[model samples]
Target: MAQKKARKAESSSQRGKAQKKKAAGQAARAATRSEEVSGIQAFIKYLKEVRVEFEKITWATKKETIGVTVAVLAITFFFAAYLGLVDFSLTKILGLLY
Candidate 1:
């Protein structure tokens, strides 16, 4: 009878330890979730501030904007043409090999 009581006490102790471990895990998860939420909120706030600053910025005039756009387009076309020529040369070389 005493041995049976001792076994029951041992089982209860193990159950207590498991419960403690589970509670600790839950607390750790909550802490991590809160930290993640705070980090995301901070990032969002930073983006909002950046947007506001951009709105206050003195943007380029329409003439300047058009000029910049045209320049970029021209540069893009030049690079595309350059790469296409390179690719064509390589293709020809490989074709001769086969």
Candidate 2:
């Protein structure tokens, strides 16, 4: 009867120790999660600041946009024609040499 009582007490003490270790591990994990959450919050704050700065910028009007677009297209067409002429000249020169 005495031996049975001793075994029960020892088992109960071991169970208490196991519960304490589990609680400590859980506390450590919570701290790690909180650090991760703080990093995400900082990133969100940075994005919000960028958005505010963009709102302060001046955008072009419709007329200015169309004017610039037309100028770009004209320049692109001129360059394409110039390059095509150069390619044709080079091919003819190469054929004569060969």
lDDT of 2: 0.97
| CA lDDT scores, all candidates in order | 0.96, 0.97
Candidate 1 per-residue lDDT over residues 1-98, each given as its tens digit: 99999999999999999999999999999998877757788899999999999999997999999999999999999999999999999999999999
lDDT of 1 at 98: 97
Tens digits of per-residue lDDT, candidate 2, 2-94, equal: 999999999999999999999999999999887775778889989999999999999999999999999999999999999999999999999
Candidate 1 regions exceeding 4 Å error are: 1-55
Choose the strongest candidate by TM-score.
2
Clashes of each: 0, 0
**What's the TM for model 1?**
0.45
TM-score of each: 0.45, 0.55
Candidate 1 displacement at residue 19 in angstroms? 29
| Candidate 1: Cα lDDT at 85 | 100
